[model samples]
Target chain A: MKRARMENELVSKGHVACPGCGAALAMRYVLNVLGPKTIIVLPACCWSVITNRHPECCLEVPVFHTAFETAACVASGVRAALEVKGDNSTNVLAWAGDGGTFDIGLQALSGAAERNDDIIYVCYDNEAYMNTGVQRSSATPWGAWTTTTPATHFKGQEKKNIMEIMAAHRIPYAATASISMPEDLMAKVERARDTRGTRFLHIFCPCPTGWRSSPDLTIELARAAVESRAFPLYEIFDGAKRRLSLDPAPPAPVADYIRPQGRFRHLDSEQIEAIQKRVDEEWLSLLRLIENNPA
Target chain B: MKEVMMGDVAVARGVKLARVEVIAAYPITPQTIIVEELSEICGRGELKARFIKVESEHSALACCMGASMAGARTFTASASQGLLLMHEMLHWSAGARTPIVMANVNRAIAPPWNLWSDQTDSLSQRDTSWIQLYCENNQEVIDTVIQAYRIAETVYLPVMVVLDAFILSHTSEVVDVPEQEDVDRYLPPFKAALTLDTNDPRAFGSISGPMEYQKLKMARHEDMMGAVEVARRADDEFGEVFGRKYGIAEPYRCEDAELILLTSGALGGTAKIAVDALRESGAAVGALRVRLFRPFPADEIAEAIGDAPKVAVIDRNLSVGAGGIFAQELKAALYDRERRPAVFGFTGGYGGGDFTPEVVEKIARRALEMGKPDSPTLWEAIP
Candidate 1:
């Protein structure tokens, strides 16, 4: 069956995003789903510079470019202002990069989540600080070689479990999504849109420049990532009820996901095996959570 | 209604009268009570505003900026360390032209963990393009806060209403809180000249080329310069409605004075008392209490201090490498004009020490004997 095209003039044609930029795709799908009545608070990230220079905007929605580590709190204030202005229908969205969400902006995000502010927060996880010349961030996976974590000194620490952190806040809806699966991604956005309190979406956006991968393979690699259980697609409802969007059953080997990206090119066989072991352990841990919550 | 209240409570009352739509603040000593009263007012539904108990001062100001960008009248208060933490967003709010009215209880900056009154806290942020209004007492604190909205909205610049920590913040005084209807008639609801509207989708704070960036900065600078007249008119109109007016700079008994004490904040009140006592002693001295610090009120100040042989600037706050901030700015303001006085800068009353009228009298007596300032700042009450 032919899938009808989902389109909105929400994202203009000539945004300065890199080709095959999953972050750009993620923004498009999110904006299309959320519609033009949405206001986005963008922090210091690639998109901060990507959305055309001053006096020229690239989106159909108003984007409030704010300081780093301020997206969530700014959105909280925006939502409150909108409510006071008798605009309960307009969506206030906080869009940030992984560094902004998982590291510098974590406190603000937690503050908003704890308050259960009436806003949606989306952290488009590009896995590293792709905006600032591919620096290592907390979201940079183990064994990934960013500029800061170079050559022999690949990222030794594991990617921070941001989902668990947001879940601990017990917000109304928290979900992990991927640009490879736009339908499921848009679905989660719709769910978040319907929810009144703080809704978080952790979107896996593979960076072509930062990952040193061909632009054409961005989506395929994103799909491979989920199938290998490297970045599972799941949701946590009120921090308890769990549901998987896509089952990583009979999962492909982690190497299948790792081989194409140059960021992981320095990994030896033993390192890959260790990573695979970690992946399996994490997958089992997630499966148990899904079973117990049974959403 | 006439009710005796602390300066903090008067600030909260003034914010309510202005009908501020959003208030986001973090608790800081000397500035906490203002937010506390606002929180209770918001909680009890006495004031129709959203009060966000933000986690940090940085978030407090950032939240205010966001709310203001979305076309809501926003307010926040912080001092000393909290104000320093919000330094970056201070520039952000003003550069974004948010028109957020913030009350800053001037507290001494740390190193020794001081929580006393000091003007250095807000004076350090002078370049951030925020219109700074220094109040002499609780009456001026409330009046300036309500007038801040009008001044800020008119010029599209943020306004910081500054009062001395504890000297004014905790001190209770009989203040005639203006009626809300009167305020409403005096100042209308804020309608942003440009806003983040769903009907009009646009991106704010996008990266700009140097040319456009410089142009924006220049435009903001021009508007900021015009805020003095706007503040003057707003205060005049506020007086017409509420029957109280504090000019940008108030000159008292300077008509035939031999010496004039240039002062700001609560020190102005003390200076007035000191001037009256000096007059009783048959000294031809007067007081010039400057209410507005930014858009400096140079013309009014220069005119007020005309031919007064010696002008002693009582600076309760000092700049470490330089001298008193107001004294420094005053020299610059008077440099281009003729008929200027030998300005004697006396720096004292830091770390919350009492800046008594006696100290003012002592400083004036010392200035009366001086030909000109021996140094940039004379460290008073120090061996």
Candidate 2:
């Protein structure tokens, strides 16, 4: 397929995002895909601080920094105001982290989705509350070690299925993408931008700092998660139709993904085997869903 | 045109006349009718606006704040628990300088689930830095909502127009609704000085350190301090356009009086009647009704009091450990005066209880015999 003209760099160098920050790369891809005619409403997340302080902003588009649990509603409001002003060309994007999407901001996000507000909401899932010193969030995978969930008593529950939760809202569109493939991520963003009401994109991001892995392993871990069926890439349309964006041709062992992260180092062989079984079941479930729905 | 409408409905009329661009609110008792009326207006195409019915008051205010930042005139309404729920965004909106207008029905706080007229709900948020205006009647309710947009847009701060639940909110009265043409001549369309726009690309509400943070706070304070004057001028301009005006702190029959009765909100009307009865009985008494509470209007209040040897202040709200809020703040306002009157603080008329003229008369006669207050709060009977 022939591509459209190249876009300008949106995320400039002045941003405070850390070294090898998958969130930074994801933001760069999303913003560049949406281009300069976009407004970003950021809630309390790593990006809220990583976007830098007053007297300086690194993004090329206008930004509105809102309260902790207000990203979705605020984005809806901005979209409403823009429409009232007779300017429908500018896109409203709500960029939030895992905690903001799955925990504190869940109600507001649900409200916006229920209203089918005209905006794009992207949740960059870093797996934990990495901004506040690696606190355990609902997004944290089971058996992961966080500050709140110590190594002795690791996380005992499953990570929240946020994409499914958003799809349940029956919004116009919802999709899952990973930073491991910039082309796929940007393609999903273009699809989201082309759509109208309440498009949700869940982007899997690897946090080397919080995961206690080497900075160079960020992209590799992101890729391994997809290759190992730990995180699958797919799209849901109108909450009814589903299609697989990427189905790994040859699935790798879950240990190749989990073994590198120190947060999951405490898991024994038995625990790892249980995780692999669960992953296999979930992957099959997703396949059945896509086959049945047939987008 | 003359119309008999409830205070909540009057608020809707004021908003319609002001040509508000966006309204986002949640439904709570007494405050519910404002949004209901607005939704009908929007649906009928009588008012060109967007009405977003949110799930909670927190989201309501958050949505309004965002719209305001996007250069749209915004409004919201809540009461009691709902207002309490919006506490964080109240401070956020003011600090962000969004200039959103909100109406709060003064309902009693819960514990026993009382939902009648009380000032404590709005008063509890005095420190949030939003300009607060308490009204005595439906007329003031409408006028203040219109004037609030003017004052708030001038100061770059949010405004809260408060009216007693069930008293002004549910009750009906005759009001001269201003024509839209007159209101348009008095107040112009909102053009946000600082806003979100992709054309220019600006960042708002970014994190800041002490060096810039404190200076921003000081600027907020200074502009807030200047808001009363802006409000007075707005009222004056409205009077010029529509032939009606109410001062920030209105003095009634206060010339050469030995005793003064000060009150706020709906209780002010009862106090005035009691003052008139006391004067008929050969007592030198006067009435002063304060409208503005956040800036406190200390200079205007002190000027209104003017050499009265005694003051009897009736407050409908409490601070628990502290006494009546208005009386306590009144003392603070008069402390710098060379010959401040001996202020007698009286607390009652809360929790949906009736505050009659007889209660004010009794309090005045009781305070008349005393040189000073025996206690911080003198009671006129409230359980």
Candidate 3:
């Protein structure tokens, strides 16, 4: 797929976002496609702080800074209010971190999906709770080092399959994108906006501060993630129809995605190989789901 | 037209009459019946509303928030652990001023994991900026639900109507479920002052720096405190239409009594009975039922207990290292008053334990004996 570049320069330069902050770029692209008529529902995450507390907003759209776990719920409320006033033209977008989406906000997100609530829920996956000093979240990849999971006792759990969970709800639309793929990401946003019911976009957002990598490497890491099939770009409709949006490009080694970041620095050759096997298994499973359910 | 019903059913009936547009909830003990009845009503097309089946208590509130923000009259019910799970969104709903109304079936929090009655779950959320109303019977539960919407929407604040777990939620009583037409005539469709207006765009939930953060918070606080009057007016209007009035603080037998018992929820009935029994025994004991919790009704409470030698507060919930939650609030209310009654606090009837007349009589006797104020409020019947 040919990735499209963003046109509108919605985000101004000299903002306070850390270099290599995938969430910042994700916001820029999302706003570019969503336009100014969009209302962003943000739960507790780096973006909440990154937006720079009230009076000084980074994005051109309206942002509702909600609690850590109520992003989907708040957005649902915002959408309902808009509908009531015969203002259905505005888009209600819930932008949350992996900790908020995959863990805390899962229940609300699931409920919204089951009801087919008219809203867009975007999960910016930075793996760990970066805003709260790099703590481990369910989205944190296995064998990673966070403040909570010291190098000696790294995270042993696999990153939760959030896309599968959202798919299980049988929502109208669900897709995965990455910060590195602006065109694909914006295209997914446009697709979600066009559809009704619960639409989810899971963006593979890299965090240089939390991942222990150079700020400039964020986009490269995101691209590596997709190329390695570690984070595939795909979409599901009604939990039945699955579409693979991007074919893996030569299937880059798992180490190509993991080695540059400090979070995975402690992994030995065998651990890296183990991660590669797990990624391969997940990729094959997803591929099978797509092939078996071709529309 | 008044028929006997459980407090939970009355709440459901009230929501129906109010023409709630959306109902979202997860089933929890005590609270499950309310949502079940609501769903059945929606399923039968009796109420034109969307009944959302949520996976957890947290989602219930979130779904309701969505519906409420969308300008629908939204509602949900939960108890104890469920209320605890919805803790995060409680602030969101209030901070956003979404005006969602919920019925909290007051149940004890877990660790010991009991499903019986307690107020800790909802009372613990005092700082969440919600307008809270506690009910004494099935009738109040029904009436309060209706009144909550009026107050919530008027102030642009969310409101929680709390009923004791089984004592009120499960028990049957005669309740006059108001007519839908009457409710419609009285409670108009919600017109949110602040909402997502695309034509005239505005920023919400922006980060506030030191310059305006405190002022914004103070404004919210003032609004919350102002809700006390708003709730009273709503109740007044409800009574004018329904012909029954309930004040923020309901005084029962407090006149010509030396000792007064402060109670809330279903225990108010028991306390009233105990007061009658004590009167028969020639002991001057009275009862005071608190209906509105948030805004505390501090002035009314202090005045209601006026000149009584002693006042005993029976709380069905605890506050850990602190005493009962109600007791703590009452103490704070009476802290600066001169010639205040010797307020005594007692924590009892927790986690579905019944508070009978005997228990009330025992607390009254103890309060009469202690005539003078005591620090570190006393526990009622603690082993």
Give a tens-digit lDDT track for model 3, residues A198-220: 89999999999999999999989
Question: Who wins the lDDT comparison?
Answer: 1
Task: Compute the lDDT of residue A181 as modeled in candidate 2.
Answer: 83
Looking only at chain B, model 1 earns a TM-score of: 0.98
True contacts kept of 1: 0.78
Ranking by lDDT: 1, 2, 3
Q: Cα RMSD (Å) per model?
A: 1.5, 1.4, 3.3
- Estimate the TM-score of every prediction: 0.98, 0.98, 0.89
Model 1 regions more than 4 Å off:
A1-4
Q: Is candidate 1 or candidate 2 better by DockQ?
A: 1
- Candidate 2 lDDT score at position B92: 88
Q: Write the per-residue lDDT of candidate 2 for residues B126-187, one digit (tens) a residue.
A: 99999999898999999999999999999999999999998899999999999888888888
Better of 1 and 3 by lDDT: 1
Error of 1 at A217 (Å): 1.2
Q: Rank the candidates by TM-score, best first.
A: 2, 1, 3
Clashing pairs in 1: none
- What lDDT score goes with residue B206 in model 1? 92
- What TM value does the first chain of each candidate achieve? 0.98, 0.97, 0.97
